[model samples]
Target chain A: MAKVLMKGNEAIGEAAIRAGCRYFFGYPITPQSELPEYMSLHLPKAGGVFLQAESEIAAINMVYGASGSGARVMTGSSTPGIALKQEGISYIAGAQLPCVIVNMMRGGPGLGSIQPAQSDYNQSTRGGGGGDYRLLAYAPASVQEMVDYVQLAFDKADEYRNPVLVVGDGVIGQMMEPVEFRATAASDLPPKDWATTGTGGKRPPNIINSLYLDAEELERHNIHLAEKYNRIKENEQRWESVGLEGAELVIVAYGTTARIAKSAMENLNRQGKKIGLLRLITLWPFPEKGFAELDEATKDLLVVEMSMGQMVDDVRIVNEGKRGVHFVGRSGGVIPSTALVEEKILEILERSE
Target chain B: MVNERTILAGFGGQGVMLMGQLLTQAGMIEGKEVSWLPSYGPEMRGGTANCGVIVQTEPISSPVVEGNATSEIMMNTPSLDKFEKDLVPGGKLLINSSLISKKASRDDVEAYYIPSSDIANELGDTRIANMVMLGAFVELTGAVEPESIFQALESRLGLARAHLMDINKQAFARGAACVKEQRN
Candidate 1:
């Protein structure tokens, strides 16, 4: 297949289609509006359903309904829109429905800005909606990764019978890059026997519900969800480490911020500075194993993000104060330049010295 | 090229985004790594529109070229004023002299004053001014081959707009010629 130049948002839509996701219900939002637009134009041609829901809340409920019916389903929105869908997302998670949710994060708190941001890190990783649940969130750094991870998210969601989230900043949604959709191996997923496919009077009708009125039954349900989350945490921690060997400092970043950190690392390394980068691919699992393998010479860890400092807490938690944890971030749609990141790293190294 | 980070800035209708996309597409056709990032949203709706394009030999680290732009293609004066400082020292600056009156303020970077709009007007279409500027960029930087851009154009325009190919090619040649004439 020839590499085609495509926006990240469009690539995500194509990836979902190629992954056999036949149902897309989404409300349009900036930075991510292109994804739904692409779906609207292409999904029907691929023999799929693309419905523009009345609201984000309605869109997510549609996702829950579609996934519960044993269909590969997806929905996308930006930060504020994702907030509106939180209740539906919680319901889907609680019901253990297999679905994919794409959040092209924009600067936020409340309709903050239309530009790219990583402010949704905590919201995505720590469960934005209520309940004892953890979303298997993958934060993709590039357009190519967006394609690959969205496909992976579908498989993972089905395999675990849980909702999977692909979180990226607006840059990943807006930028255009050359991408070739390499073929992914189809996972040997188990049958959706629990799906609410109408029974043909051959067996008991499977009911998809999160409600367990009895306290003991609810506790058992919570325990089952916790065990599934633990298994995910154990098996799905993915990360990439660059130039970590004998490095003085390692920068922890994900999504578009990791790309900036890479550029900064390259520039500083050209100047003979020992800088490394740890890019998180899976944000929910948090990839603590990458930190454990850090070179002993690494004295400081810098958490770079597009938000004020959401991922910094996770870094500190994993680091356990063993290394000097620092944070450098920009909020409200401003991306930190490579030079600014280099300056921060130098400043941190100098202070440590 | 190790890395060529180019910023193409102009008003919304000036085809700056298309120019960036063309460069990126050409780079891709030539089997190089490329990325195009536009300053989107309201700025694209009649405000100053700009896009950052990176064409490089190695894998790109970031798609943004804010503080380390290796080249600036300014189609208007406001674009020149806004993006001139972003170009690194020894970078290349191509100003559309037909629209922008002032010369580049920086001395460290090599500046080319190409009246791209004028050249496109001579070629019978002002919309091809971006192609003219793009041609000058190709001649100046050799980031991607001129032939690669033609292939890119074929793929982008397809069969529907095939009639406009000749003028676009002419504008591109005129742009490269303008740079060659300046160098001589």
Candidate 2:
């Protein structure tokens, strides 16, 4: 396929169309507004539905309803908007609906700056809304991946029968890069036998609801959800590594920060600093296996994020006390330059030296 | 033959973003990896606007004009004032002489001056100034074959814009001529 230059947000919307996502419901939010805008303009042309709901809450609920009916559906927003959709997200998880949610994250605890951040790491991975559940989330570092992973997220959502998150940031959402989209078949996806499609008197009507009056039944459902999460952990973990062999330390990052970290590591290695990078593509499963077989020569790990040490917590857990996990973060939308990240890596290495 | 990190800055209406897009599009036409990132938020809505573009033979890691930039294009005086310090010494600077009074003060950098807007007006279209500046940039760096830019232009502006193509080509040549005259 011939490459065409595309902005990250537009590419995401187009990739969803290619992946058979015929419905998109979203409200406008900065950094990700272009995504819904793209959908609003293109979805109808593709014979799909695009609705700008009154609020993020209504939009995500609409997604829940559509995905419950077994149509590939999606919704997109930034951090604050994603926060608003949390209640519906939890409901979707409870109902075990297959859907895609994209959060092009911006700085926040409250209405923070409209700059890129990885602050939503905890909100996305650890079931931000409520309950004991995990949503499969992928952090894409490039515009190409922003397109490629949207398709992957849809497939993964159907495979696990759960909500899947494509977590990017303002930088990844706004930047332009050359990309080419290809057809992704949902043919390999498991049959959606649980969809709320009408039975046509062939059998009992399929019911789709999350509310359970019986706590015992809810617990049984939770067990089933937990088993699916474990299967995702086993089969769906994905990551990328650079210069791991005979390296002393590796910087762990995802999304925009991961791209910046790669540049820093490349420059550092050219300067003869024995630094490397391990970028997490799957943020929710946390790619725990990425750290399992670290080179014995590896002495430390650095978790770099555009937040106040959120994913570092997971890195610490995944490291299992094998090595000290140092953290370098720039939060509230301030991105660390490649030089700054390199300085942080150099500082960590110098302290050990 | 260094990978190019470029900063293009001007007023919001001056087509600075489009200029950056054209450059990256030309890069893609040449089968090179490229990235373009624009200034967002209030700054874009305000008079000031800028974009960072990188054209690389290999994958570009960060879209920002990291470690300063190797090339700078200033469309007006304010942009020159802002980005003058950011251009690497021994780098290239293309200035819109039609708008700026003071030149880049740095002596180490090779600066090329063009009255692109004036030239574009002479060619009967004011907007082709961006194409004029692009012509000079391409001349200095050999970033892409000259014809690839026109193909990219059609892809971005559509075939209906074909009418403007000849003037833009003239604007490009005028700007490239200015650079050649300076060398002579």
Candidate 3:
């Protein structure tokens, strides 16, 4: 296929449109502003609706409204802006709506900086908003994956009847890549029988709300979500393990950070260093099984990340403290050097031997 | 397989971003995994434009290329000041002799002070200087097939540009020939 050069943010907008996502509501934010801008220009031309909501909160609710009416909908924001949409995200998850929310993450505790950072790892994987809900999160390392995941996110959301988050760092959102536009029809996805599309006279008015006054009703809802989550754990865990066997150390990373670690690992391996990389493609559901094997393979493990020490904590848990899990990270938008990562790996290998 | 990483930097109009994109697309066409990452900043406000391209046999995990140990930097003056120290040992340094009069200070990194702008001007448009550097990059590093690169460019360029395709092909050919002539 002839690959067309496209920016990561614009590719997401195009992918969503091609995937039968006709309704897009979003507010502008740096590193991700191109997404809404692209949608504003392309959606109307594609015979779709593109609304620039007043705020992140309003944009997410607009997504909620559109998704409720059985339309494939999406909204995008940066870290701080995404934080504002949490209340709405929780509501979407609670109501079991199928929609895609893109968090082109930036450095932050509160508007920290516009540079890309994976500090939102905990916020995204755990609970960014509030509730016993889990967003099926996909971390895209490349622009191609960024585009492909938008379609995948929509499909997964509809299949599970849940809100799926396409989480990416600012770098991923801003970078340009050569990508071939692949088309997939909306009808190719699962049917939306449960959607509140005016009930279609087959049933009465269906309510999509998170509030359940009765404890039993809430419990039932929780159980149902739990069952769905279990299925997600079983069938939805996506990961990539490189050179794990006969390795002395395993490095766990994801997204752009993981790609850098791969280079570092290759350089080290060429020098006769026994090293491997375990990359988590799906950030949510955490890929416990993938980490379990890495823990068993090598006593020395390194968790390199673009965050302070968030994903490193998960490495510690899966290692069960039996293996030495060391963390090497650069926070506040500073990407760790490959040499720095190599130095850490050499240090771990030396210590282990 | 030959693995190469380049950090091209200059002002926004230098077409550094396009060079990175062309190289990445070429790599992809040769059935290699490619990644292109831009310098993290506002692009249009006359800010310094920097971009990284990784062309390799294996999948690229990280797009962020560091200054230290970054081999083969194609820089234009101030960009050389910012990123030259990052070049790896035995890495070639290509400079725009037209715009960047002052050469690289480092002794360890091999420097090629090509009059890139003069060469681009002779070719009619300095915009494809990035493409010229990319042609040089492929010849020097052999990260992917040069034939594959021309093919990718031909197929990937938009229809609006169909009229100007032959000129670009010549530009890339000139770039490759320049490297060969230098070697001879």
- Best candidate (score: lDDT): 1
Q: Write candidate 3's Cα lDDT for A199-304 as tens digits.
A: 6677878777889999999999999998998899888888889899887898889887887788899889999988999989898878888876663557787888
i-RMSD per candidate, Å: 0.6, 1.1, 2.2
Chain B TM-score of predicted candidate 1 relative to the true chain B: 0.97
Per-residue lDDT tens digits for candidate 3, residues B1-184, read: 7467788888888777777777777787777777778886655755688888878776665666666334554647788888888788777777777788897788987776666677778989877777677666677667788787777677667677777677777777776676777767
Q: What is the lDDT of residue B96 in candidate 2?
A: 96
* C-alpha lDDT (0 to 100) for residue A263 of candidate 2: 88
Candidate 2 stretches greater than 4 Å from native: B43-46
Q: For model 1, how does the per-residue alpha-carbon lDDT over A239-317 read when each residue is reduced to its tens digit?
A: 9999999999999999999999999999999999999999999999999998889999999999999999999889998
Per-residue lDDT of model 1, residues B1-184, tens digit only: 5589999999989998988998899999889999999887755356789999999999999889997889889999988998999999999999999988888888999999999998888878889999999999999999999999999998889899998899999999999998999889
Q: What does chain B score (TM) in every candidate?
A: 0.97, 0.94, 0.89
lDDT tens digits by residue: candidate 2, A47-131:
9999999999999999999998999999999999999999999999999999999999999989898988999989988867878
- What does the lDDT come to for candidate 1? 0.93
| TM-scores, each model vs. reference | 0.99, 0.97, 0.89
DockQ of every candidate: 0.89, 0.77, 0.55
The DockQ of predicted model 1 stands at: 0.89
For model 3, the superposed segments whose C-alpha errors exceed 4 Å read A1-4, A178-190, A199-202, A295-297, B67-75, B119-184
